[model samples]
Target chain A: MEIALLLIVGGVVVGTFGSLLGLGGGVLLVPLLTLGFNLPLREAVGVSLVCVIVTSGASASVFLDRGVANLRLGMALELFTAIGALLGGTIAFLLDERLVAGLFALVLIYAATTMLRLKPAASEDVATPTGEGPTGAPAPAGRLMAGLSGPNYRVRAPIAGATGGVFAGTLSAILGIGGGLVMVPLMHIAMGVPLRIATATSNLMIGVTASASAIVYLLRGGIDPYAAAPSAVGVFVGAAVGSRLAHRVDVRVLRVLFAGVLAWTAFLMLRRAAGLG
Target chain B: MSASRPGGTLEIRLAQLLRIGTYGAVILVGLGTALMVINGRSPLDVAPPLDPSRLVSDVLGGRPAGFIWLGVLLALATPTARVIAALRAFIRAGEREMTIVAGSILIVIALGVVAGTAGG
Candidate 1:
């Protein structure tokens, strides 16, 4: 009973912040379940994925409607990400959960470090559009680039987007945090998408991307509906509220706090792995 | 090291500092994993709590950690795209910069790989 309440409360916290910062909040979810609720890593990851997908879906919808998310750009990139995800998902089906956790900790460390060092500031004018036709208007012209690839649909720009998605898909399946960690950066740099747009797009796609792998896990009986249900409920609420308030918050400070939490979690995970807990 | 070009030396030092900081963070996490292994501790989180959902995990005893990293990267692609879009929005501010973002994320992935393996 207490655990049930705890899940909701935990979900509220994770969802709310998750929405606000656009974080997968899976980082928060994993430790909360494992350390606080005593769930096995596998179960925790499964539950975490379900919650993450719901929240991401809700958030993504908002961004998509806003026209900030480029469907052509995203879909084009998904080509590579989908393949990468398939391979990664297959690997996940074949690996152990603890090692997954350890890798997660390491990824957090990497993410936080990257976050600290990475300057989202654009360094060049690569966005100079040719003909500058549609200012502040939706240009379906992006669709034209999809087929302009090198011999045939091998366009370099589209490949960058695909690469981003491919990596994001693989990471989501393996880590359960939905792979926004990989997506945000790759899209920003490789594909030349704006950071804000990339995050919004990534959050939007997480549900579908996660669901794709989730299907595999479900078929294999990896999903526990009970755990997924409550988690989904909690995170969905959190994500909704978080998205509404995202712009109002101080992003830099929130990120710092998030990074700190990740570092601390890594410490705890290490302690647990070493039996120090 | 240069007395004449104080600002230039400082800029060089800052770049060096950030890179070192990035690697140092990775190394610390790696060492922790090494310590755990040396202590004969296992890496699996076998039976996580029931309330937290036991659905999607890879089960440590029988799986590889690389799969997890790969999954994380893929699932995050879209949201990461938004974040990049957000970053790229700064391009409108007139100083577009993707290098720092890319470099930072790459460092994280590389570091993540290092620490993840040590614990495994």
Candidate 2:
């Protein structure tokens, strides 16, 4: 009973921070379960996958309702992501836990750097009209790519986006993340998608990407129902609360503090990987 | 482009589906956790290994783990359900390219299932 309460509270904290920071709770969740709760790394990853799915389901709809998520583009890229997730899920079971930990530490360091350097950019950038011909019709780049073009912006370098999708999916499965850090930048920078659309579209793809690998974890008995149940429920509640409070809170200080915490956690994870912890 | 309109019928329907799935899973999982605590089981106890074949039977018997597992399954299924809904919408809209894209995703998920079961 006490442990269940603790897990729920811990999940709420992780969820709140994740939502506020725009990093999905899974990034915090795996570390919490492994370092704080002493759960095995693989099981923690499995549980994190479950939580990521919950977050995605809860938030993706709102983005869709706001017309920020690009559904056609999301679905198109998801094909490659799902494939990569399957491959990564399979590989996760084959790799050493320590190596996974090392990779996770690297991801944490990267996340910390991103958080420290975070800036409030205007979501509505001037659209680069790359794929359109005269008279506002699509250029002869074919119908599929043309269909992916948004009202204000035409998707550019789709091939690069698709390639990034595969990489993001692989890391998501292996590290139990939603891969927003990868997808959001890839879409906004490389694919010419607006920042708002990129974030929303990344949210749309995350659930499906996590689901592909989650099924593998489920089939392999990697997830623990007891831990997953309370944590998932708590995260769902916390995320709802956090997103509601997002616009009101000034997160600059919190982001810096959180980045420091993440760096310290990364150090501990590296030590654990070396059997020094 | 007609089919790709933002906040279109398809997006609305997809949103509704996701909301339902999220709420339903949360309820089931929450209830299952309560049931476990009431039944004198520690939530920290090592969970029994999942047996896919017994999910229905366990749920019918009112096993706490069964409900929890079912909820997890529901959560996992939500995304796939979204994809399926999108695929149907695309097909109904006569979106040939999108239909192919959605169908290919399903195939990929199916392949993942195959690999998982085979490896497990």
Q: Ten-residue segment with the worst summed lDDT in candidate 1 chain A?
A: A146-155
Off by over 4 Å in 2: A20-22, A118-140, A246-257
What is the C-alpha DockQ of each candidate? Answer: 0.02, 0.78
Q: Candidate 1 residues A16-98, lDDT tens each?
A: 76665555677678778787777777667766776676677556555555444444344445444445544565577668766
Question: Per the 3 Å backbone cut-off, how many clashing residue pairs does candidate 2 have?
Answer: 0
lDDT of 2 by residue, A31-67 (tens): 8888888888899999988988887787777778877
RMSD of each: 17.6, 3.3
Model 1 DockQ reads: 0.02
TM-score of each: 0.61, 0.91
If chain B of candidate 1 is superposed on the true chain B, what is its TM-score?
0.28
Q: Which CAPRI tier for candidate 2?
A: medium
Docking class of 1: incorrect
Each candidate's interface RMSD: 17.6, 1.2
Pairs of residues at least 3 apart in sequence or in different chains that clash in candidate 2? none
Please give the fraction of native interface contacts (Cα pairs under 8 Å between A and B) kept by each candidate.
Answer: 0.00, 0.80
